[model samples]
Target: MASSSRSTLYENLKLVDTVAKVKTTVKELRRQKEISVDCEGNNLSREGTLDILIIGTVNRKVFLFDITKMGVSAFDAGLRDLLESGCDVMAKLMYDCRNDSDALMHLYDVKLAGVLDLQLVEIDSRRKSKQNHWFLKGLKKSIEVYDHDEKSERTKKNGTEQIEDAKRNGTTIWDKRPLSPDLKDYCAVDTVKLFSLLKVFRKKMEREKMLEASERYVDYFRSYETFPETKFYRHGFLPDEILRSNPRDPKVQYNDCQGCKKKFKRARLDLVNAGEKKRANFCSCCSRIITRIENQPIPSQSFA
Candidate 1:
C-alpha cells in the first residue's frame, strides 16, 4: 500500500521567522523515499523575487490535499528529502531547473548529487537551441489526475477577459494571501497532472518501441550546456534564420543544438501525438560528432 500523507502551510508574509517550520519539514521528508515534487514560485517582484510553494508526494493519489498544520516548512523538508534520497528519487519538471535554481538554493543549500535531473537525463531531451521547445518541460501529456483539457479552455477564456483588468490593476501573488486560492488550484493541478502524465508515459514507454525512440531523442537535450527548458537555439550555436521557426510548428523547422550540432524536431511531442507517443524530439545523430566528442552530447537517444 502507498502511504499518502499530506500537510498544509499558511505563509505569514509579515515574518520570515514564521518560515522556520518550513525548515523542520525538510528534515522529515529527507528520511522518506520515492517522491514526486513540484514547486510554484510567483515572480512577484521586479527584482525576480519568487514565492516558492511546493506540493510533494510520498505514496498517494495525486489529489491536492490541505496540510496547513505542517506549515510551509514542509517544502524545505521536501528539498532535503529529494536531495538526500540519492539515486532512488527522480524529480521531474516542465521548466528549466536553472531558472528556478535561485529560489531553490534557499531550500537545498548545497550542490545536490545522486539525483537524476531529467534536465541532465539525456541530450535529445535538449533541443538544438532557444528555438527548440523540446526542452520546455511539461509540454507533453504524461497523464492527468484531473482532466483539465476542459479547464484549460476555461483558463484561456478567463485570461482573455482578465487581460484588461490585469492592465488596469497589476497583481501581486505575495501579498495576495492566503496565497490566492486561484493560484493554489493552478499550482496543485500542474503538479498532480505531471505525475499522472508520468504514470501513463512510463507504461506507454514499456509497450511501444516508437515512443521509446521519442524519449531517447528527448533525453539528448538533458545535459549541462542545454537549457532543459529550451535546448535548441543555444546562445550562439546556430544562425539567426534557423533561430526563427514557425512557433506553430517548431518540430518541422527548429535550430541545431550546439551540443548535438544537428537539427531537432520539437513538435513531435505536441498535442497531436499525446496518446500515441511520448511527445518529444526525433532521431538526428551526427555520426561524426558522436565519434569525435570526449564526453558525448546529451546522447540518451535509446534505439532498440
Candidate 2:
C-alpha cells in the first residue's frame, strides 16, 4: 500500500474492544506477511498493566486492541496465538520488543516471536554508516530521523507535544478510560509509521549484507530467562552481543569481563594475571576498581 493511503487508514484507527472485534482483527492479521505492533500502559513490563496493544497491517489497516477493557478474553479470543512463536503471521515489527516480550511471557504466557525490532535495525544502520555511538533511540527521535513524509512528520511532532503536555499536567494518560483524541492519535502514529521505517532500514541492511546480523540482534532478547528481575531493565549499557556479532571490523576480537561478566572489545579489556595459569580479563572500569583495591595500604602487624 502507498504511504499516503496507509496514513489515512491509521487516522481512521479501528478500536477492537470486544472478543468479536479481536477475532476479526486476528483473522485479518494472520493473512499479512508482516505487522507493526506497539504496546502502551503504565510502566509496561512484566508487573505493569498492558493497557493498549496497537497492531498495524501492511495493507494500512490499524487496530487498537483495548487490552485494558478486554483483559484475558482478548488472548482467549486468539490474540495469544497471533503473538506467540510459530504462528502463521510472519513478523511483528516493533521498536523494542524486550519489555513487551517480558510482559507477554509473564502475564499471558505468550512467548513473542518472529519479531523484527526496528530499534536494532536502526543501530545496524548507524554501524553501517560508521556512526560510533551505541545509544538507543526512542520512537519519536527515530521518526524524526527516518520518516521524512510531511504528514508523518507532522503527526510525530503533534503526538510528541500531546504526550509532553499530558506529562506536564501530571496525568496518568494511558490508564484513563475513553482514551483522549490525542492519546489515540499518539498510539496510532507509533504503530503505523513502523512499517515505513522498517522498509527503509530493511533495504539498507540488505544492501549492506547485514540482514543476517540484524536478525541475530532481534532474536537476542527473545529468551525469557535472559530478562532481568527488575521489570523493563536492559541487559547492559551497550549492546555487546550485537557489537560482537556485527563488528565494523570483523578482525577485532571480544572477551567477557571477569569482573562484570559482560562482553567488550578485547582492546578495551585488560589482562589480569592472578598467578600460575590463572589469568582473567577485566574491562576498564573493573580494572580500575581492582587496581584501587590492590593498592590499599596493608595494616601493620599488631600481635606481640
Candidate 3:
C-alpha cells in the first residue's frame, strides 16, 4: 500500500453542499511522497484551494487530505502537526503556493519552506510544460489496478462497484466503502496502497533521473504569480505583500515609485558621473520596475 492510492470523500461534499474535487486531489497527493498532482478540472481563475492546490514533502512521504467541507477540528489537528513540527512535510498546499502564504496560514496556520520546485526541474529535464502538463495522468495510466482476492471484496454501496468490480476487484483487489467495518479494511488498504504507489513512482523517477523534472514542474507552478482577484484574500504573504498600496522602485536607491509616465533621478552611479542630468532620467520603478516587473523582486537576502 505504498505506491499509489486515493480515497474519495463520499458524503463530505454532500454534507457541505460543495464539490468533492478537493478530497479526491488530496487523496491522490497523500499517497505519493515525491510526485506532482493538480486539478485541471477546476477554474484556475478562482482563488481558493478549492480551485486547485498540489502538495508534496521531502520526507520521502507526503499526505494530501481534502477538507473542503470538513470542520475546524479536523483541520486543526493536521495543521497543528505541521505548524508545530516546522518540517517540510507540507511544502505546497495553496492555490498559489508561493504567494498565497496568507491563505495557507489562515487555513492551515503554518509557514512554508522556500525550497526547490518542479518547474526548475522540468527545465533541467528538457521538457515543455505543455507536453508534460499531465505528468500524473501519464503515471496513472501506467498503473493498472485489479482485485487481489474476490473473497475479500466487500459488498457494493452505489452499484458502480458491481459494474466496475470485475476490472477493479479481481482475485487480488479489496475495494469497498470506508463506512462499514468490512470495507473499513478496504479503506485502510487504499490509504496504504497510496503510500506504496508513491514509493514506487518516486523510486522510478529517482532511478531514471526524472525526479528533478518532477520537482521543477512542481516548483514552477508553486512560484507562479497570480494576480489578485476581487476577494482580496491572501495566504502565506504578510500584510505588506498582499496589498500594493506603497509600491516602490526596485532600481532607485530610495524613493516611492513614480508613475510610469513620469521621470526621476537615475541610478546614483550615473548621477555621480555628471553630477546631474537635465534630460530627466526616470528611476527604475518609473521606467521598468513597476511597469515591467509589477512585483516585489525576490529579495536578494532573506533575514530568515
lDDT of 3 by residue, 1-304 (tens): 2224333322111111122433444344444333322221112222434311223333323233333434244335443333223114533321223333434444444433332333223222333324442122211222233223232233223322533554454421222212233233222323233333444334323322333232322232234244433212222112111111223578754422122222233332121123343222333322223223434332222111
Ranking of predictions according to lDDT: 2, 1, 3
Question: Any idea what lDDT model 3 has?
Answer: 0.30
Residues 1-304 of candidate 1 have per-residue lDDT tens digits of: 1112332312111111233444544444455443444444334211243354444443432322122333335335454445434344543333223334433444333223332223222222234333353322332231222234666434434533443465457753432345444444444444444444445344323223322332332233332342322333222222221212323463455644333444544323121222343334433323223323323333344211
Best by lDDT: 2
> What lDDT is reached at residue 89 by model 2?
42
lDDT of each: 0.35, 0.65, 0.30
* 1 against 2, candidate with superior TM-score: 2
When summed lDDT is taken over every stretch of 10 residues in candidate 1, the lowest stretch is 8-17
Error of 3 at 51 (Å): 6.8
* Candidate 3 residue runs with Cα over 4 Å from true position: 1-64, 83-96, 99-102, 106-108, 123-304
Question: Model 2 over residues 73-134: C-alpha lDDT tens digits?
Answer: 99889988888744234777888776677677667767677777777778767877999545
